[model samples]
Target chain A: MNITTKLNIVPFVSVDSMMKLVLAIGIEQFLTELARYVEEDFLRWESFDKTARVASHSTEGVIELMPASDGKMYGFKYVNGHPKNMLEGLQTVTAFGVLAEVDSGYPVLLTEMTILTALRTAVTSALAAKYLAPKNARTMAIIGNGAQSEFQALAFKALLGIDRLRLYDIDSTASHKCAANLANMGFDITICASGQEAVEGAEIITTVTADKKYATILTDNMVGSGIHINAVGGDCPGKVELHRDILLRSDIFVEYPPQTRIEGEIQQLADDHPVTELWQVMAGKASGRKNSKQITLFDSVGFATEDFSALRYVYDQLPRTGFYEELDLLADPDEPRDLFGMLLRAKQAAS
Target chain B: MNITTKLNIVPFVSVDSMMKLVLAIGIEQFLTELARYVEEDFLRWESFDKTARVASHSTEGVIELMPASDGKMYGFKYVNGHPKNMLEGLQTVTAFGVLAEVDSGYPVLLTEMTILTALRTAVTSALAAKYLAPKNARTMAIIGNGAQSEFQALAFKALLGIDRLRLYDIDSTASHKCAANLANMGFDITICASGQEAVEGAEIITTVTADKKYATILTDNMVGSGIHINAVGGDCPGKVELHRDILLRSDIFVEYPPQTRIEGEIQQLADDHPVTELWQVMAGKASGRKNSKQITLFDSVGFATEDFSALRYVYDQLPRTGFYEELDLLADPDEPRDLFGMLLRAKQAAS
Candidate 1:
């Protein structure tokens, strides 16, 4: 690229381009490669600047800005979670992100994170399950069967070799939709009538429901002793998926404690409730699963570094796939001090 | 716009389009109108949810995310300030912003804010001057004529009717460039040898030097009684333009106290030192320019609401000007829960 193009243009990955790129790479491989990036970042989590997302809470939902930097690169994701949006035929969560250079503070990539978010979230859950889930885990129960359900199934299958699926949703149509989407993908699938029935013989359970209020998608009685819980949907204050008793029984692992305490399942517990940082387990500083009968929970509210990894992954793919368009997002004057002169010249050129 | 377009496409005002839009409406008139919006927002300042900008500081410079919401609409600007960038033929600052609706939590507009920020910062200064500047101020002195200098000159001309200009810069070429950019724009221009020479016999002195250090552009002795000082450049920590003695002599005005205390010229002052909120003066809650001999200083660190006003103004201008392009930034699946299904269809369509 020329100097003007280099300064002025930011490569934007649109929804269409993201879909095309994912399809070109194949979804399972994309998730697998993305998981590696997420795992690598998690292992060195202390190197990043991490903070609870800055959220603007309205009566309807919340809009958040999640920012992270690993000293070399900076990234932020603008995401909105409006559970009611689905009633109006809109996605419950929509997002976009930017990744920039720490040296110049210039954005190198802008991308639609709606699809990428689903992919990263699922891969993160599977990565957690890799250490926490029971050995030779084969069957998984997905209790939401919504937009994130299929990705969860695929990510588990890609990373852990789990090929059995049990799906349940409040609306059976959602379960059907998820199962239909995953058809012929080499998984044994079952659409269950209820969350309890779905987790009957499952070794891992995922609750990915969408609601803005307190929810108990899984109770203590429903969860067995050894099942690893991937709690995906209880990501905001007053929004949770598992029962307090269930959380009390499970060993919770969180991405960031300050954030998870306020927005994750652990919010149901006291402030000093003990939880393990997932990074420590990946770095071998802490143990993941202690025994066959120990229950583990990955309280996944989604952190900024995961999104950073996703952005970095997509930015690296830009040259190989060429699935992005250049956006004229920044002002680049020939002379840096002559911004006003640039305008004057533009006027003169136009006239 | 169709439903799909309404949901997926955000109107993007690029650098090229922003220049075109500004030229379409004369620059003076644009500044005047934009100043009106800034004034209106300031009039209802209590309506906004304000916070000190979120900044990520690097050894070289800083990048910031400034967000504001008035319960109905939310807006944020991503800006980076790197003073060393000019040497590499890059802008000292570059910015872009997003304006989104609160009800649905969907972005309505995404625009390049490099030009818009310059416009809004200048307009905000002029708006503050309307309340605090000495009455009938016709001649203005502008020191450090860099990228922001010409806009500052034009804004003062548009809002305060200060037609006589005295410009000075360490590098005289910048002053000449400022003079040349403003040629035949209804101004009596003079290139002065020093800041003291620039301020001689002028009612208003605007110090807008670009440096990321604690260099005083204006000394206490140079600032006389009855003069209004518009301090614009000392915006971040360790960056101040006016000497502390000049600040002590003047009744200071600021955009937001929490922010201005740390980033504005008043960072040199005690934490509890009295400073007037510009909005209070605009809303008739506080006094401005109590007497002709009393010094007044408008310490502008640039705030989120000003950028909000700028984004709102540009969004309102979209239909009339049609100067923006639609960016497919959001994912809008036909069925909200069938995001995977949408991807499947895309893959099938591509195949």
Candidate 2:
């Protein structure tokens, strides 16, 4: 596009285009590269403008806006979680995001973040596992085999070289579907009938269910010493996966303390409970896994910076892959103050 | 559009489309109708969810997200203000917004709000003037013939039948442009050399200069008894258009007092300074223009509900005018829990 047109146009990545881009790069590679971006941003977390996701809660579910800016670029994601949406043949979570230049406050990209969010969340889990999971771990129990299951399975395989999968879901078909999707993607799959059976001999466990209410997907007896827990589902208030007893034994790592305290599994704990920031672990300011015998829990309540990084990564990849369309999203009048003149001219042209 | 396609597509109104929409409806008629929506929403203000705008301020500018929700629908506007942007041939203020169904949290419309915001701001000012301005007011002094000046003039003309405009700006070219734009638009205009000169026989004085710092566009001496002052320029924390003395003399009215106390001309007032919400007056719970000899000030710092009303108005108009394009902005899978399956199918189809 010409520079003049570029000023007014924003690159939009639809779901189809996002999928094409992911497939073109190979999903495993895409997750790995995206994880690197997330990691890089996390390492410099102090430089970002961080705030808790602004949530509007309703009787059924919640919609949230997550925004963050790192001096130069500003990004925000609009997402919703309605547990009952599935009954109406709609996804529990659907999202879209925009990334703009801070200097100009003009959006350069708009993308279907439902898919991108799934990818980023999975990659973030794997990134934490790389630091908190057992050394040379080869087995993982995924207790919720829904939309995020396959991505989590692949991300762990790509990031941590874990090829063994033990999957279980409240719905058997969901587990079967997850196993079938990863059937040819290099995994020894075990579709278990119960959550306990799923975590039988696994070194790592990822809980990612889609219920809006609190439920124990993992009991204390199911989790033993040295196993890492990637708690991904219990993100909002009043929702949790692991039992409170399990949290007492595990060393919890969180994204942002203020947000995680309200949304993460640690919400079960006191506001003053000690927890390590994952960014500090990555920055060497804090330790990750103290020992193999000490259980490590990654209380993953996704933060805005991760989405910002995901958008930045996608923006950088746009020119290389050309997997986007230009959207006429901003007004670019020839003269800044002649906005009325522009409207009059448009009327004249239309006539 | 077909139902299946409509489920995944959001209608987007671009700048050109928005301009066309305004022209097709006629600017005067559009403003009058928008003012009606604003009035309707303001009257039922207690039924809406309101919050102060979330702002990310920088040395060069500030970017904000203003969101509000009625029980049924939700809306948000992303806007930025950069005083230095005008020097770089960019608009000091630019915006876009989205309206979504509260139940589904799915966006139904996305539109370029730069033009729409101008209209709504003007209509909102005129709406306030209808309740607060002197009876049968026909003369308005516009101090700041910038981008917003013409809309302000026309909205008053349409809503309040103001036919005379005295325009002034620090820059004479801006005043000349404002006059030339309103030349044949059914208004008798005067280009004045100074701000004081502009207010000379006007019944309503609107101070709308675009500057980042505190400014005295209207001093205590410049404002007189029984005249209405539409203060629109002093919106952000450190910006003020009228002198403290002027605020002390006027019977102040505001959109949201908590927000206006920090961002509007009332920021200069004491914490205990009393102000009436304009919504209350529109709702007939409070009196407007209590006496003819009293000065009334509509401290117009803008509000999110006005944007919500504007988005609601645009959404209602879309089907009738067809002034929008469908955007593939949502991810829809046959099975809500099978987002991964959707991606996998896309990959297979691509192969």
Candidate 3:
């Protein structure tokens, strides 16, 4: 039977709605589901033609386009990261994507990514932690508790079997919000006074601060052996979070090397610094965490492939649930040559 | 006083409706008006930061993202060209675009461009022809007779005093359709059997064939002196309509050499091939045709600036006329951190 009676116009989940969608689905279930999809796409990674995103930076922020095609279909995301936007009542990260048929380049999906990005980021963190974090992990220290922190908390709880969260933010309200959301999720909470205090005994530490600076969110002394660091915030060049010494302690993993080298925390290291491609690890061509005591770092800057997978999943599943509206977005010419004719008729109809 | 009370959403003119909009505006009037906007934007050329569009090519077609910024605002056009799509009852060309604030990357306008592409292509052709075609030009040869043919005829009438159209198409029905559309616009028409026969006494020759190959629609021997050729269809690499011999005798003009080299008809020529940029001629920094005897060719591939100008104009004009439906395509969050809260409220309201 057909899943839905109506063709779902592109489901536009606003940033606000996305937060609810995650909550309604429960963080654990969402993370588990999203991870399954990301893993499925990563195994066949060679099928994709990947490129570094094209970015146009302004004095305030940067807008970028990340496009990739897996021979049969093409997908791209237009995203912007403006940390100061929160003061203007706007989310720091807002995005949208288009998935088109590679044969004809017809746009088959369009979606609001402000909320999805949060979900995808959290899901990605959980996915990496599953492979890199110590087994039977139960506690996660969330530093820089801003927009993406709650999702990270939920994702870890769902995927890594984490039962406790230690939250710390420069702004206490951010920490309060994250802890409040995790209250009923079976994750025990600790409101830490500092990033160091939060990471003291956590098995996995997730840093998602929004400040566009070279912030050392976690230093070398803050961590003990066997902790996995999911570094999510430092994506653009000159924007980083982890200390140089912390990265040297762990075996570094990256999504796209050329890009991660420029935008991830690895940007601080030498060009010839040793790093392993995450896809290799996912495909078993490379190892994930060698041993429980081996310090591991997943320098996640977010890749176009993850967005492609997210867009694909959203287009496939969300429509069946009736959370979308059809848009008369693409022009359909009844008689292609009579384009001028249709405009005249619309003018007549309006007049 | 609000001049328009119809809607708040920007009017999305579909390819079909865009045709009707063009028809109502009168192709000649529309083309003439479009030329003014294009000419004005070209004069302030340095005010725009130009980059060649990013493209993904497959065996069947190609998809491209063309972006540009002018200090205050940013714009991008997502377009595709698939010659075989017509066989599937889909138009060979389909497009859409977004206009956003440079500071925040907030999209202010999103529109259907399949129809607007036709209008802009025609407008660009007429603008180039105005500067390079013979003063007494009246009759024109339209060698392709597809979706773009009527727009070409109208733009020529609007910008230059050319009211006579000599058309030809490999498909006779395409020529019939173009002639029928222009019949009401008061143009004297000739539906020729072949490209050679159509060029006789035609002062302006526009070749817009859709084959993605280097097939010579117009050979060197057939094109005579004092004829201005507006080559609109050869827009990607490995596609050409004119023989190399024609380039030897004609003074070629292009828009944005970096892009023209890749997507325009100039792809067949050597890297250092001499072709003057059209913007230079518009700004009077370079000369146009030397005399009526000179053969001029404008290898027109669609550019980002024209889409930017057209989007700006449409966005501004829609408010005055009131024919648009606003889409909640962008997310505007209140209390940015409580994105989850927004979803909670939306789901509650829906329940």
* Candidate number of the best lDDT: 1
Candidate 3 docking classification: medium
> What is model 1's DockQ versus the real complex?
0.86
Q: Is candidate 1 or candidate 3 better by DockQ?
A: 1
Looking at model 2, the pairs that clash are none
lDDT score, candidate 1, position A333: 87
TM-score per prediction, in order, is: 0.99, 0.98, 0.94
Q: Write the per-residue lDDT of candidate 3 for residues A1-351, one digit (tens) a residue.
A: 222222212234444445555556655676688788888888888889898998888877888889988988788988888888888777777788888888877777767787777878888888878889999888888898887887787778777778888899999998997777556657789999999899988999889888888888888899789999989999998899998998989899989999999899999999989999888888999999989889999999999999888877776665445455555556555665545555555656767
Write candidate 3's Cα lDDT for B1-351 as tens digits: 222222212234444445554555655666677778788887787889888999999999899998888868778889888889887666678788887777877776777787777888889888988889988799999999988888888888878878888999999999998887676677899899989999998988999999998889998889998999999989999988999888878999998999999877788889999999898999899888889889999999978999888777666655544445556555554567765545555655767
- For residue A299, give model 2's deviation from the true position in Å: 0.8
Question: What TM-score quantifies how close candidate 1 is to the native fold?
Answer: 0.99
Instruction: List, residue by residue over B150-269, the lDDT tens digit for candidate 2.
Output: 999999999999999999999999999889888888898988988889999899999888899988889889887899999999999999999999888889999998889989999999
> For each candidate, what's the DockQ?
0.86, 0.78, 0.51
Against the native chain B, what TM-score does each candidate's chain B reach?
A: 0.98, 0.98, 0.94
Ranking by TM-score: 1, 2, 3
Sort the candidates on lDDT, descending order: 1, 2, 3
